[model samples]
Target: MDLTVKIKRYNPEKDDAPHWESYEVPADPLDSALALLLHVKWHIDGTLSLRKSCAHGICGSDAMQINGENKLACSVLVKDLVDDSGETVTFAPLPSAPVIKDLVIDQSRFFEKYRSVKPWLINDTPEPERERPQSPEEHEIIEDATKCIMCGACTHACPSTWADPDYLGPAAMLKAYRYTFDTRDDGTEERLDIVDSPDGLWKCYTIFNCNQACPKEIDITRWLSALKRRAVTSSASTAA
Candidate 1:
């Protein structure tokens, strides 16, 4: 089958503004959007630039706005986008960030927000000779969050992050939730302090855009609400 791919394109040195560019490419319904893009880059236009690695959905390097939602191009199948009457597939760089080129957005700010949350373990105790142990139940609490490859989809989908560039978006907040809730970690107080601020977890309005945008299918909104509750409880106890 032939698929019509419409990509939102931009080039800083050549284009005054981003524009739509389309290509008709033959593909299997089971073929990935990344495969189609690769075809275009290799055959149609060598100047087309987009980030992709592994091409297997694990790297999260190919996140893009597809069919008006944030998704990893490598994971979304061609058939999943086809409708009864609609035959067009649209690709744009992830929203809420500056576009660097054709279908690529600047992600430096996204990673900076991620680091602000301190995603690593924070146990200050002497290092154990063996790996620190965590119960199965405890590990399950963070299993979904651990699945995050820092794709920036959830963050780009967030309205709060769009409204306030300073807001430490869902990706960072989810990381905070993962570390703050870990039974083996002891950084809850510090992590909560960082997220409970004006531009932190409180900025989230529970709109659930992050839930819809996450290609991993992790219930980011639910976990974020969990973080909000944890923050509130921590504040109450600290006051008492």
Candidate 2:
């Protein structure tokens, strides 16, 4: 099948703003968005630049704006995207981040926010002589949050992140909840401090775009709700 892929191209050296460039790509029902991009790069525009590590959806490197939503290029099929009128898939860099070139975004701010969360579990006490004892019930609470691949899809789709770039964003907040829910983690109170202020959890507007954008199917809103509840109760309990 022939598919038209309309991509937004930008070059700091040449263009003042991004421009749309469409290409008719030979695609099958099984063709992925990433495959279409590769075809365009190889044939249409040799100057096109983007990021792709694994052709699979797991790497999160190919996350970009497709038809106004953040999604993994490898995960979205071209057949499902195109309309009956032969309208093409629209491609652009993820929102709220600086575009380095045509679909590639500067990830330094994303990574910096991730680091601010102190994503790893921190136990004040020393490790047990053997593995720390834990039950399946205890592990289950944090299981979904751990599925985050740091894709930045959720963050890019988040309205709060777009309004305030300093906001920790959904990915980091989900990571915060992962540890907050962990029975073994004793740092929840301290971690809450990091996300308690304006640029932290309070910035969230509950748009639910993060949950919608998550390829892992993680319930970011539910977890964020839980974190908010915990934060409130913890503060009350501490005051008492």
- State the lDDT at 192 in candidate 2: 92
* Candidate 1, residue 44: lDDT: 98
The list of candidate 1 runs beyond 4 A from truth reads: none
Task: Please give the lDDT score at residue 61 for candidate 2.
Answer: 95
Model 2 TM-score, all chains together: 0.96
Q: How many backbone clashes does candidate 1 have?
A: 0
Number of the top-ranking candidate, with lDDT as the measure:
1
Give lDDT tens digits, candidate 1, residues 84-153: 4378888999987999999888999999988888889999899999989999999999999889988999
Q: After superposition, how far is residue 47 of candidate 1 from its true place, in Å?
A: 0.3
RMSD per model, one decimal: 1.1, 1.4
State the local distance difference test value for candidate 2.
Answer: 0.88
* Model 1 lDDT, full chain set: 0.91
TM-score (all chains, Cα) for each model: 0.97, 0.96
lDDT of each: 0.91, 0.88
Q: Give the CA lDDT, 0 to 100, for residue 180 in model 1.
A: 91
